[model samples]
Target: MYRFSYSEILEDAPQLARERERMAFDRALHLLRTVEARGERGAERTAAIAFVQDLWNVLLSDLLDPENALPEALRSDLVSIGAWTMGEVGEALRAPERSLAALIEVNTSIRDGLQ
Candidate 1:
């Protein structure tokens, strides 16, 4: 059996949350990159796109929540970044010539920032 102290339980809660977030972003980035390498593989592209969309939607919702602990200005900026990410994803999907590099770059940046 294992035991924990109250102080330990209370500390670094957000670090755990951030680690989860970082992993999700990494997974999403991997999916997107795979789709990019596969070119026109329909199912992979669809899955990757849906994953990115869902991830961003969840993030946006959390940012918008009144109980969210992030600073007001920082949350606002993150919301804007999320909006741009969604926009770029939509645009890339709509245009055959458009590339997913922007999506990859932005996701990488966000994931790195979580450190």
Candidate 2:
């Protein structure tokens, strides 16, 4: 077995974390598009809403934590973006002929940026 250096360990953890985050966004994006195509009355809508809500909830909690490594300004901006995203989720449910374009767009942007 090979031993890992401390710097490698640190670098590896964040890279892994970013990949996980990217995958989570990927899942959410897929669900959102499925919901769009299938209509909001189906199981797909239920799943998409649940996944997006849960994903953002976890991210917001992390960003709000005082010990979070992200800079304060960046964290604050993300929190604001999350708030908007959550509002869109609510609207997507409550409005007739609701379009998930905003949700899809924002999540796609963030997912692409995770690289």
TM for every model, in the order presented, reads: 0.84, 0.84
The positional error of residue 106 in candidate 1, measured at the CA in angstroms, is 0.6
Question: Model 2 compared with the native: what TM-score?
Answer: 0.84
Tens-digit lDDT track for model 2 on 21-83?
Answer: 899999999998887877767666867887999999888877786667677888898999999
- Which residue pairs collide in model 1, if any? none
For candidate 2, which ten residues in a row score worst on lDDT?
A: 3-12
Query: lDDT of model 1 at residue 30?
Result: 96
Per-residue accuracy of model 1 over 1-115 as CA lDDT, tens digit each: 8864322432557677778789999999999998898785476787898899999998898888776677899999999999999898788767755678889998999999999
Query: For each predicted model, how many residue pairs clash, with residues at least 3 apart or on different chains?
Result: 0, 0
Error in Å for residue 25 of model 2:
0.3
Pick the TM-score winner.
2
Whole-model lDDT, candidate 1? 0.83
Q: How many backbone clashes does candidate 2 have?
A: 0
Off by over 4 Å in 2: 1-12
